[model samples]
Target: MSAPGKSIFFMDLARNAGWCEGRVGERPIYGSERLAPEGSDSPAVFAGLLRFIGGRLQAFKPNLFIYEAPRDPRHMGGQTNLAAIRMLIGLPAVAEATAYACGVLDIREAEAASIRSFLLPPRPKGSGRRKEGELKSDVFKQIVSLGYEPKNTDESDAIAGWLYACSILDGRVGAAATPLFSQT
Candidate 1:
């Protein structure tokens, strides 16, 4: 279990774009690039994601992992982040986290919906959601408020997810608290 205010690792996984955030006693360390293959492409794919996960795990060795895991699809032939999800599920570090995830309490998404709510941008009257540019700006602004300048949507989402997870860990976002890996 995490001691109060302990640092944690956060991941925001998407289609081909993903970001990992690490906050150690309040320091910003973010990543989007993957580990490169030494010679060939055989291990490149899994290495891309797995290596990132592993590197973070090895470096931080966090006590808890607050990950916005890939959303599983309900329908057949639907686009899902199965590849990334599968790799994450099988990682030794992740398995370790799962075994002792009680302290995690909750996980938050940095996807469009979460970003929209977390960073309520000034939308047009009768607007549905913030557009790409607006979201980027809004997300950037929110991260900046948190004392970090986000370079892209992926980075913003990762940082936003981290912030939400911190709130959950700190008992700030009440009631909506559910188990980790939930899309609700």
Candidate 2:
């Protein structure tokens, strides 16, 4: 594993067909779009997004790809439900295609679920929700030298993955500040 370039390429996908704003701490980063065309769940749309990301990734030839995993497709239905099924179903295919197209690895969190845990806290017993935000605070503290809050959870998670990869590349994790958000 190698450190991904400083220029990271990130994309988020929701199961429904609408865009949503994301926040990394307090900063807002917007770029959520449905891969599929209107009223369609075509594979081409997912393939196209992967191609677009692949093109953007060419500049740095990023060693990593941080993508948002999709929600369960069955739950995505109706006007109120904005999740895009193509985003979920098409991600694995897109990741494989993108990695082949770019010649660099696309690290999907779902493939190795524990690989992403460097940035998340353990889920509490009997609680279905994972403490990702709590883990984010821990990571920020650990990477104080980086000196910036990610623009959203995706960004935060991506940064954590990057840091974890960096540690693997460099053979050590750099010292980080204890995040102010941490409970003393």
Candidate 3:
């Protein structure tokens, strides 16, 4: 378990990144920010994302930093968009670097599937795989169950990840919550 009185900052990184930050027992503050704008190149997007994360880190000064791990490209089925995949992979790298630069030594990552499992109800025994929209709706519902109204799927994802992180910090979860990266 993490130290008492620790604060955490969680993110669901993408072209439009979602973020949540607060102490474990308090109400978390969450929102999404657009990292890639029309006509912007990859470098510009990375720079903007860096600034966005860095600014928040400076503002909150959380003790721990956690973000959703990007899906493996090989598991993305027919998604062959190289640029999109690169951006997805780059976001966490940028977030990790920003956390280290900001002096937040404890950094970790959570899998999207793991977060969904921790927050969402189990599917029915005979139910098949859910479509993307259905999963987003379920995530939204889970966030609502936690008493927060997320503005979008991105925000909902970040909040769900935040809750999962809290569970890990409090020792309420076990192996399923192991960090993708841990410095403590």
Candidate 4:
């Protein structure tokens, strides 16, 4: 159960998107939604994503909504395919538009790296750099240690983002003074 007021919703958007919903001092409920079939065309996939976001917005009625900001393909070190690049770029735009249409105006985005840095411990002085998979595993372990069972990496990532947002909203960490843009 969550404390009263200041509910938040966090999402990690993708074809198999993950979401977490909770209030300030509570355990969030999180799970993933497959937006469409594996190789569906972009329009169909996006339509499914739109409906999912809209429905969740209405059902949860959260005070603030946050999602992991998608990284650009260039920054992905050439490992991502064109199809994935398109989906990653388009998902947030669809989510934001859906939130606006649903009258949930206080939307924000946090970079995956930022969430990682906030939730995971710093690397030890002489341990050499850890790979991305290692970091993700550490994050999964951390969340599990906190007594949450995440079904997959996507859900864990959403939980991590939610944890980061909760830290900021609870005054444990400082967020940027201004949002990306104001609705008004």
59-176: candidate 1 lDDT, tens digit per residue: 6656557656443445325655665445444433442344243344333333446534644435678867666587767766666665666667777777667666655556543122
lDDT of each: 0.53, 0.46, 0.83, 0.82
lDDT of 2 by residue, 1-101 (tens): 95332333444443222111222122223233445566655566766667565665565465555554555556446533333444556665675577567
lDDT of 3 by residue, 1-184 (tens): 9555578999998878899998886678999998878777777788988999899999999999999998888888877588878787778888899999999999999998888887766778899887879988988876776568899999999988988888887753322233332211
The runs of at least 3 residues in candidate 4 whose Cα sits more than 4 Å from the true structure, single-residue gaps closed, are 1-3, 172-184
For model 2, the local distance difference test gives 0.46
Rate residue 60 of model 1 by lDDT: 64
TM-score of 3: 0.87
lDDT: the better of candidates 2 and 3: 3
User: How do the predictions measure up, each by TM-score?
Assistant: 0.59, 0.49, 0.87, 0.87
Model 2 TM-score? 0.49
List ranges where model 3 is wrong by over 4 Å. 1-4, 171-184
User: How do the residues 63-143 of candidate 4 rate in per-residue lDDT, one tens digit apiece?
Assistant: 998999988889878999988888887888899989888888999999988888876667789989779899779878877
Q: Which 10 consecutive residues of model 4 have the lowest summed lDDT?
A: 175-184
For model 4, what is the C-alpha lDDT against the true structure?
Answer: 0.82
Local error of candidate 2 at residue 148 (angstroms): 2.1
Q: Tell me the spans in candidate 1 whose CA falls farther than 4 Å from its real position.
A: 1-4, 14-25, 35-43, 71-112, 121-125, 172-184
